[model samples]
Target chain A: MNRLDDDDDRPLSPEEMLRLIEEQQATTVRRLGGDPLLTHTPWGITWLAGFGALYLNYAYDLLSRSTALAVLFALMVLSMATTFFAQRTVSSQVRGEAADRGMMYGLSWMFGFACVVAICVRLSPLLPSEETGLLWSVTSMAIVSALYAAGGALWRVRTMFFLGAWLAALNVAGAIAGPTVHALLISVGAGGVFTAVGVVQWMRRRGGA
Target chain B: MTGPRELDPVIHAQARLRVVATLNTLGEANQITFPGLRELLGMTAGNLSVHLGKLEEAGYVEIVKTHRGRTPTTYVALTRQGRRAFEDYTATIRELLDLG
Candidate 1:
């Protein structure tokens, strides 16, 4: 630890200052860029509940489209409510520029997702009845996965990249598994994985690490 | 390029420069705890306090001491002046490097 003293007031030249600034920025980013609440327990539970609702909705689609959609809508609303509460809790503990950036990134992702969904809904009438739902789901998942990958690269977070890869692989599995099996896989397998990651992160933070 | 004399002396020292850079990287509105800053810079608490004191005296950074339950916690954030100083410093550096 170099203590700055007025007696030793040696000024850094422009080049030296620039080098020091870059060094400091790199070190700080490595230190503070990660937010533990990113995979919080509340977030994990919300993912599980939300994906479970979607699973049920998709499984029932063959029997009743309208009913399935209604369930899905209810689930979506519930997921959003839970997420809102989760964010509030996490924000109280994690207050920093990183948190602010995460919120901005989340908002952008939601906006992009909404746009993709709207476009898919508009195009669904043109597609064959047998393929419409599957096409929409795959497309949405692929887009989200790609965005996650891009974000991971930008932020240098390996977990985010793995998440993107997982989602993309799930899309492939969905294509082969059919709607019912795919829905089950999403709810029980993927949701469980997300929850487990969140739990681990929560525990680490609680342990003050 | 801004002349060396035009640069703020209060922000010209190496440790203080690093301090300003770290705060600036976090964004102008962000406030970091004293422990947080110390950890970020890998500086001793006494060393960090001295640099922060200099910055505070120059009105470049603001320090707040508050009680969390019974314990006192120190928070540090760059003032508007500090942010501007950093921006100017970076711009000057860029100009110098571009010329070279």
Candidate 2:
């Protein structure tokens, strides 16, 4: 690599300099913003497979309850781990206020879920076994949707906010419809939402939108 | 306040201006990899190194060399002095344009 002469001194007009600054800043943002598809697709698969198994176990008894629970637990854990590491990978690439914000946002998810667990454990003994399961699923979904909504609002992403709203509605309908139907609703409905959103984001990025 | 303020000579050049502008987007404590900044500015490594050396000399940017595993990596960050200089430069520009 050859170093060029350092004697070149040219002045830019104020308007031109401002324009250049704006253009370069925009380029930096575009280059550093991580792909949404990577974050969403794995989650889509996890929800689809996890809830599908739960539906099978509850509705058709195709798998034992313990087996279904284990599968769901494993998939959820895997999805969470994938999301955590994916975020860390992106954060590792750049350092700024955005990185700190991302860390806080990630921690917020853990905090939200912890509160859900605490609430559920406290409420579990009052409900029957079957209702306890229903309570756990509904509360968990509620927390997820609420967090998504909060995240969307924080990030100013309209699609994420709408997705959270849609999922919240689905949670209500599932709760009213009972556990078996709730499992099926989340399996197809929420899962489909995740998959569809991932595809749309992928397409948008490919199109340079 | 009486005479027109001049832009910082170090940041007045086109390439150096763009470099400072790009680095300005980063958080105060945040650092970007050498290749990362180079890619952002679309500048060759040698050219960027030259400009960065000037900035470092002026206390505008800090460059650190550290090992990431077995690979040596170069990270660059804007310093408080540099950020203040850039801010002043922009304010001066805006003042010149009568927008400030």
* Pairs of residues at least 3 apart in sequence or in different chains that clash in candidate 2: none
Tens-digit lDDT track of model 2 for A74-165: 98888778777777766776666777887898888888889889999999999987678789999999988898888789767777788889
Model 2: CA > 4 A from native: A1-27, A30-33, A206-209, B1-21, B27-30, B35-47, B54-75, B78-100
Q: Which segments of candidate 1 are over 4 A away from where they belong?
A: A1-13, A35-169, A172-209, B1-5
On residues B28-90, what C-alpha lDDT tens digit does candidate 1 reach at each position? 567777877887777788988888888999899988887767887777888998899888878
> Whole-model lDDT for model 1 versus the true structure?
0.68
A1-209 per-residue lDDT for model 1 (tens digits): 34246533675656877888988886666456444344323434543554455566665544355555565556556655665665554433334565686688768778878887898889889977545766665776677678777778866778767877886787789768776555566556656776786667556545642
- Residues forming the 10-long window of minimal summed lDDT in candidate 2 chain B: B1-10
How high a TM-score does candidate 2 get?
Answer: 0.69
Error of 2 at A15 (Å): 12
Share of real interface contacts recovered by each model?
0.51, 0.64
